[model samples]
Target: MTGYTRASALGPITEFVETRGGSIERIFRRVDLPLALLDNPDLPLPLREQFKVLREAGREIGDPFFGAALGRVVSMKKLSAFGAWVSGAPTLAGAIDRSGRGLNRFLQTATVLRFQVSEAKARWSIEFLDPGKDGRFQNELLGVSYLIDGVRHYAGSGWTPTLIRSTCVGAEQAAALENVFQAPVLHDAPVSAVEFDTALLSATGPERKQPDFGAEPPIPPPVGLREEVAMLSTIALLEGSPRIDWVARKLDMSRRSLQRALDREGCSFSTVLEGLLKDRAVALLLAQKRSLTDIALHLGYSDSAHFSRAFRRWTGMPPSRYRS
Candidate 1:
């Protein structure tokens, strides 16, 4: 099942569309979203539906850069406690780390936010975990925009990213994005990201009073058995290869019962583990600095050759070739 995003995360949607002379009501109806969600900030909207709303609204407004434009005006405050928590971090790097961890906890699910540091640059990326058929071009741009905005909060209003990487923008759309981001953007990339110098990571924000967020919201529930299993397997992968028996034990159930539960959901532990491994492998490869042996062991492979074999089976290419 696809995960849910808090409606507040999309608080700017209605106004953003209407200001551009688009009927958000019609677009909402077309996507089966309730108009009431605009007023109900606490409600959870399906992540898939949220992606559709943005895509359709962009088309309806005849603004190919609609998502990127809307992202420019989006306030992090709309993210509720999640926003406050991230903003309160002392350093820019801490804020980025908190945003990534808090995303699945307080704001949304079925997404991955990564902050990776290399020699002199840091890559902050956002990826939708659900690989459904919905058009995510707009959502992807919006996500990258948010990452850039977060950096600006600490780097100051005049800061521009070193580079922006995107998976969706074509030649025609690149200029519009360049104007918005004030940075060179590379399209058709592996993932959407904001790449900047490591120096900005330690930038500090002014000391100011933070708002009373009351209490943090409860962590969002797992979307389904598959997602639940996937989450556990991900953590287990760090320790080594994830075993079904270990996962079942963590869930407080027998191995056979857990297998049956997954069977009813039309998936198995092996499939879930494979998917997690593949995602991790791809992400590590994108870093472009990790060696084959390090990447292999990190993903729980016994050796580089074993991982190379698996990579060939999964992508019809070896890891070295894929990384290149």
Candidate 2:
């Protein structure tokens, strides 16, 4: 369910460049990115490169406010629009559902926020969903950390996740997860998720009114749900038990078309599949309660030995060692 694409972050990013009299080419060379990527907005680049590019550009102009302002353009701005949409919902949950639909209208880069609630607990997972299996764990974790930090920037300083999860493991990965969530992060969960007081999600926060973007040009129109769902489902497919062919069919596309859609969105099916296996293998291994052979079967690995090799490739440690 994931493809890497530029997914325009609005003219704010472009404006950031303009403000400094800098061109996008400057960022390409400065961040070691491919300039050809600019032609396709759906292609996702490095999150660290993204932040660094913006952070450095802002710093070069000596405006910390630019980073905060860019945040406003991308996600914080949408919270307000969503708040307006839900302003009259009878309950907080109604507002969350309403707001959830507009997620792409705000954050278009490597991210997903899934929301679910029941009588007992409310679950919302803010995932920095990566498309390929080709990112550093540290870089990916840092993106997640920045997202939470940015949300806290708009939400509150005290915000935290109930359960922190990662697609990687080992003492190093575990420590990064802990630092990001600022809580006891469990290493072996099926996904990166957070449980919270659903009530808080309902509360009237800063998201209630659209903020002016100063001088940034208008953003491109929002992409469709089919496109978003396809992208999401593909990323999820990569990170976990890759289902959602059913979901894609609903979009009136064959599995192959759906994959092409994903590729145009900057991802490939095979990459996501391997990422799912890597994530599952790591999580299963770290939990340690499962036997190696059982873990292999669970991950759809041919057998224990194959899973062991994959585990070693991803974590530089054997599943047996992780279990120990």
Candidate 3:
């Protein structure tokens, strides 16, 4: 899957920038992102663009430790559903395992979370599959900080990683990171990981009061061309209308090749895009109390009237009727 991240994932950075008197609109424009996109935390953002925004925001503010600093302020409440579920796990080990299964639900592509338990230590690592990208270091920092924050929420604020390793940091940034993590920070490592005492895995943590709805159903691992395209379309739809060529480029294939692949699956790109939009439209109508105009604009409609026509076409009823 070409993974996507929720726009809310940048909440800490957004708060940091705004507090520093930085213009978030200018930052969004610099990254070719719509300013209104951040309004809905659950909205999916292309992982590539998410990284670009982070890197640009950091560069604009001249803060080398931007990611790490942001991580410190990020709370479980800001992490959305995934964070809540992790906090509810009975032990630190359980949280790590649950996070592994649900990582894709949070980030749709280009990132991975793995948990390994050894006799001496338990290692939880996050790897950004795309290393050549601009914000690799910042992402690494952010990921590690997030893990630490989650652990502290349940394990007590005193918990710390036994060792921290990153593939992206340099000597200058290492000291700042070490101070934040309060653990040895190794730079230019093979993978970005946090190691902790194995004993801590079995240590009980405070129980979190999960909502009655419980955790989100685990997403099945995406496989094959159709699923890959569907995942990409879901991510693209969050920003605006999904484009076949854009999805093709994200999949690293030419437009013709992408069309041929869809043909083999007995579906076309337009069908996939329509299906995704309809699903998102229905979801927003039922789940959120947002006005029709806001929902329409979110789905990339020029206005509510256009959205109403599309909704009627999809469900044989206008969006307002469907909501009622």
Quantify all predictions' global Cα lDDT against the true fold. Answer: 0.78, 0.51, 0.75
Candidate 2 lands at a TM-score of 0.40
Error of 3 at 257 (Å): 6.5
Provide TM-scores for the models.
Answer: 0.66, 0.40, 0.73
Local accuracy of candidate 3 as per-residue lDDT tens digits, 190-270: 778888877777766676645322433434445677877887677667678878887887666899999999999999988
Model 1 Cα shift for residue 141 (angstroms)? 0.6
lDDT of 2 at 266: 72
In model 3, where is the ten-residue run with the lowest total lDDT? 211-220
- Residues 217-295 of candidate 1: C-alpha lDDT, one tens digit per residue: 6445776778777866664565578888867765657999999999999998898888888888999999998999999
Q: Which candidate ranks first by lDDT, i.e. highest?
A: 1
Ranking by TM-score: 3, 1, 2
Candidate 2 local lDDT, 1-324, one digit each (tens): 332323243234666567667676665566444444444444333343454456555555655334433432343322333324443344445454544554444333455667777765666555545443423243334334434443343346677755555555666756654653566666655555545555565444444434333432222332554445534443333323446574454345688887777677677655556665776677767776878888787666678898889888877888787767
- Predict model 3's lDDT versus the native: 0.75
